[model samples]
Target: MALNLFSRKQAEAPPAIEAATLRSDRFRLERQSDWQRLESIVTALEKNRPGRIADDDLLELPVLYRKAASSLAVARETSLDAATLAYLESLVRRAWFQVYGPRTGFLRWLRSFFGGGWSAAVRDLWLDICIALAVMVAGTLVGWLLVAGDNEWYYRLVPDSMAGGRHPGASPEMLAQSLEGTEGAEGLTVFAASLFSNNSGVCILAFALGFAFGIPTLLLLVHNMAMLGAMLWLFHQGGLGFDFAAWLSVHGTTELFAILLAGAAGLHIGRSMAFPGELSIMDAAAASGRRAAVVMVGCVLMLVIAGLLEGYARQLVQTSEARLTIGLVMLAFWLAYFLLMPRRAMGAKVDPA
Candidate 1:
C-alpha cells in the first residue's frame, strides 16, 4: 500500500497482553495424587465458569487453591505446565485472598461477628445444650446401669463437691475448716468468685482449641464430662446424693451450661473442618473462627458471673434452700435473657442503651 505525501499514516502500538506468570518456577508437584487433584479442579472450574468472584464463588476457593497447588506441583514434574495454567493459579489465589484477608473496618468485623446480637449465639448454644442433654442422659443411664439402683444417677451426672456435699473421708467440720482455710474472711468472697470464674474459662479454652486442632477439642469436653460424672457417681455412692444435686444446682446450672457452650463452639470448629461443604478446610475454619470467638467471649462473661456467685455467694451461704432459690433465680434470668429474649424480643434491632 502506498500512502500519499499529504496523508498522515496512522501508527498503532500492538494491543498489550498481560504477561502470564510461570507457576512451575514457584511450585512443583511431588506426587501423582497432586496432579490428579489439579486436573479435577481445573475441569470443574472450567465447567462452572462463573464470570467473576462472588460470595458463592469465594466460598469455593479453599478447595480450588488446594487442588491447583497440588496440580501445579504435578504439572511442574510433567508436561502439564504452561502459561494458561499459571493464569488459572493466579485466579485461584485471588479468590482465596478474598475469603480470608482482613476487611476494611470495625463495623465490618462487628457485622461479621454479631449483626444478629445474642440470637445467633443462643441458636448455637441451644444446639449444644441439646447435645449436652443427650450426653447427660446417656451418661446418667450408663451410671445407673453400672452403679447400684439405690444410687441416684443424677448424682453421677453432677458431683457432690460441685453440688456442695461433704467428702467421704473428711467430716463436715473438716470440710468447713478446709473451705474456711482456702481464703480469709476479708477476701473469701472475691477469691471464690474469681476461682469459679476462671475454672469456667477452661471450657472456653477447650472450645477455642478446636480452631488450632479439630477433633481434639472433644477430648477436653469428655474430660470435663468425666469429672462431672465421677463426682456425681462418688457423691451418690456416699449417700449424700440429694444434697449434692441441690448444691450443684446453685452455680452448676450456669457454670456447667457455660462448659456445654464451650464444647459446642469447639465441636462447631471441628465439624467445619470435617465437613467444609463448598469451602476449603482453611476457609471454613476462618469463617467458623469469627463466630466461635464471639461465643467464647460470651462464655467467659458467663463464667465470671458464675464464679462470683459460686465463690462469694454459693460457698459461704451454706443454706440449701437459699442457695437453690438464688440459683433458680439466676438460671431463670439466663434462660429469659439468652434463650427466650433472643427469640421473642431482640430481632434485628441493636440496643444503643
Candidate 2:
C-alpha cells in the first residue's frame, strides 16, 4: 500500500514540473500591458499631430518612460529572453527620446529666433552698440577730413578696385554711372553671392576676434567706415552727392546696420570677459557668448537681406527718391521689429491654447 502511494506522488510531481513558468516569461508577461500602453502613447506623440495625444497620456509620459527604463535595466541584469530584451531596449530608446529629446521643429525654432530672440539680444548690447556707432562715425569723419586736407590721402584710404574710377578727379557722369547700380552689369547671381560671402566673412571675423579684448573688432569697424567716407567724399567732389547717397542708402542702411550689430556683439563678449565683476571669466564669457550668438545670427540674416537689395532692388529701382524711400522703409521695419515685436525667451513656445 505504501509503495503504491509513493508511485502516485512521484507521478504528480512530473506534471507539476511540466506546468512551471520560466523567470523571463513571467517578468515579460507581468509588464507587457504597461509596455504596450507606453508604446501606443509614444507612437501617437511621434506623429507630432497636435491633438492626437490625450491629456492623460501626456501627463503620464514621464512615468511610462521611467518604468520602461527600469524594466530595461532589470532585463539586462537578469539575462532575459533575447526577444524580450530586444523589445524593451527599442521601446526604452524611443520613449526616452520622446520624453527628453528636442521637440521644436525648424520652422517653429526659426520663428521664435527671428521674432524676439535676436532683437532682445541686440537690445542687451545697447551700450556696446552706441560705442561702436560712435567709433564708426568718428572713423568716417576722420577719413573725410584726411582726404579733404590732402587729395593724396584719397588714394591711401580707398582701394582702386573698390573705387572703380570714382576718384576725386572723375567727372560727374562717371561718378553717377557708378551709382547707376548693376543696370549694365552681368551675372548678378554671382555678384550677389560674392558680395554676401565677403560681407559675412567680415562680420564673422569681427565676432570671432572679440576674444582679443575687442581691439580688432574696433579696428575693423574703423576700416569699413573709412572706406565709406572716402567714397562719399569722392562722390561729393564730383557734384553727385545726392545720387551717391541714394545709391548707398538702398543697401548701405541694411549692410551698415549689420556691421554695427556684429561689432557690438564682439564688444559685448570682450567687455564681459574683461569685467566679469562677480562672475568668473568663463561664466561671464559663456553668458555673453549666448547673447552675441543671437546677434551674429541676425547679423548674417541682415547681410543676406542687404545682398538681395544690393543685387536687385538697388539696380531695379531707378529714381533717387524711390531708393531713399525703400531704404528708409526697410530701416523703419527693422527698427520696429527689433523694438516692438512680442518678447519671449530664446526658444520658448507660445501657448497653443
Candidate 3:
C-alpha cells in the first residue's frame, strides 16, 4: 500500500506541471491560425508580391500586428514555450522591416538624384564655386603674363607631349593646321583618349585631395588654368589666337566648367573641415562630403560629354563659327540647368509614404 501511494504522488506531481504546459498549448492552438495567416501575408509583402494578398487582408495587417504584439506581452507574462515566443518575435521583426524600411527603388532614386539633387548641391556650395573660379582666373593671368614676357616660359608651362609639336616657335600655318585636326583617324583616337584621361585625372585629383584642407585642390586648379593660358599665348604668338579660341570654345566650355565644379567640390570639403562653424568638424565634413559627392558625379558626366565633343565635333566641324556655336550652346544649357532651375526648398522632407 505504501509503494502504491508513493507511485500515485509522483504521478500527481507531473499532472500539476503538465497542466501549465497544456494551457500554453491550448493558447497557441487558438491563435496559431491567425498567426499563420498573418505570416503568409507578411511573407508575400516582403517578397515584393503584394498583389498576392487581398485588399481586405492588406487592410487587416495593422490589426493583425497589434494583436500579435499583445499576445507577445501575454505570452511573456504567462511563461509561454520558447519556440512559440521566438516565432512571434521573428514575425514582428519581419513585418516591421516591410512596413518602415526604405521603399524607394533604384529608378526613383536615380531620377531624384539627377533631377534636383546635383543642381541643388551645386547651388548650396556656390561660395566654394566662386572661390575656385577666382583661383583659376588668377592662374590664367599669371600664365599668360609669364609666357608673353618670355617665349621660353611656354616650354616650362606647357608640356611638350601635351603641345604635340605646336609651340611658341610654330608658324601661323602650322598652328592653324593643328587646330584643324591635322591628325589622322588613328591619331585623333589617341589624342581623344589622352585628353580625356588627363582631364579626368585632374578632376579626380581635385576631389580626392580635399581632405588635405583644399590647398592641393586649389593648386591643381591653378595649374590646369595656367596650362590653358600658356597654350593660348603660344597660339596667339603664331597669329592663330582667334582660330584656336573658337576651336577650344567648343569643348573648353564644358570641360573647364566640369573641372571648376570638381574643384568646388573639393574646396567644399576643405572649407567645412577648416571652419566647421556651429557643427563639429566630423559632422560638417560629413554633410559637406555628401553635397560635394553629388556635384562631383554630375561633373564627371559633364567631362564625358566634353570628351565626346572634343573627339568628334572638334575634328569634324571645320569652321570656327560652327565650333563656337556648339560651345556656346552647351555652355548655355549647363548654366540654365544648374543655375536657373528651381531648387528644392531647404529642409524639405522626402515623403517615403
Candidate 4:
C-alpha cells in the first residue's frame, strides 16, 4: 500500500533531486570527497563525450576539477558510501596526473631552472660592451688630435711609474738590465704584487664609476686612453717600438681586456639609467647591476691571470717576437670566447642573477 502511495505521490511529489544526494557523516576523511567527485565527474564526462575535446576546452580542466571537487566535498561531508569515496579518489588522481605528470627528468629540471629571459640579458651585456668600445675609440681619437704632431706628447702623457724605470722604451741591453735587476724571487714577488694591485684597483674604479651614469666611466676611459696613446708615441719616438710593443703586449692584452670589461659593466649601469625601458630608473639600475656583476667577476679572474702572466713571463721572456705572439694569441682566445660565443652557452645559464 505504501509503495503504491509513493508511486502515485511521485506524480505529485516535486521531482526528486536532479542531482544525487548523500547523508551527512560525523567523521571527515582526507580527500575522500575529492576522490568521489572525481569518479562521478569522469562517469558523467564519459556519458557526455562530444568526441575529442578542443584545445580551448582542455584549458578549462582546472575549472571542471574545481567544480567536481566542490561537489565531492559536499558528498563526503554528508556520508557518501565507500564506493562513492573510491570513485572520487580515482577522479581526482586522474585529473591531477593528466594536468601535471607528463613531463619529467633532467630536461624538465633544466627548463624550470634556466627557462627565464637570460638570452636577452646576455645580449644586453654585449651591447653595453660595444657602446663602451665606441666611447673608448672616441677618447683615443681625441687624445690623438690633442698631441698628434707634438714631440713632447709622449713625455707629457707617459707616467714614469708605469715603465718600472725601464725608460719610455728601453734598448735591448737596458731591457735586459731591468729584467736582471728584478729576476730574483723576491723582486718578482714584489713586481707581481704591485702590478696586480694597481691593475685590480683600476678595474674596480671602472666598475664603481657606474654610479655616476657613465660620465665618470667615460672620463676614466679618456684618461687611460690618452695615457696609453702617449706611451705608445714615446716608444715610437725612442725608436723602441718593437721592443715596447712586445713588452706591453705580453700582459697588457689581458690587463687591458679586463679593464675594458669593467668599463663595459659601468656603461651597462649607466645605460639602464639613461634608458629605463619599461622599468623605473631604480629597477633598471638593479637589473643592470646584476648583469654587470657577472662581467665584473669574469674581469677579476682575468686580472689575476694577467698579473701572473705579466709578472713571471713578461720579464723572463727575452725574445720580443715570441712574447708578442703569445700575447696576441691569448688576446684572440679571450675575444673569441667572450665576444663571439653563443649567448645560450655563455651567460644565459641558470641564475642569470
Model 1 alpha-carbon miss at residue 306, Å = 0.7
Off by over 4 Å in 4: 1-123, 141-156, 163-186, 340-342, 345-353
> What is the descending TM-score order?
3, 2, 4, 1
lDDT of 4 by residue, 173-235 (tens): 665455332344447767788888999998899889987898898789878887776656555
lDDT of each: 0.58, 0.82, 0.82, 0.66
TM-score against truth, every candidate: 0.55, 0.72, 0.72, 0.60
How does residue 183 of candidate 3 score in lDDT? 32
Deviation in Å, model 1, residue 11 alpha carbon: 25
TM-score-superior candidate, 2 or 4: 2
What TM-score does structure 4 among the candidates reach?
0.60
lDDT of 3: 0.82
RMSD of 1: 12.6
lDDT of 3 at 60: 86
| Segments in model 3 whose C-alpha atoms lie over 4 Å from true places | 1-102, 182-190, 344-353
Q: List the residue pairs that clash in candidate 4.
A: 23-78, 24-78, 35-88, 35-89, 36-88, 36-89, 38-91
Query: Candidate 2: lDDT of 328?
Result: 90
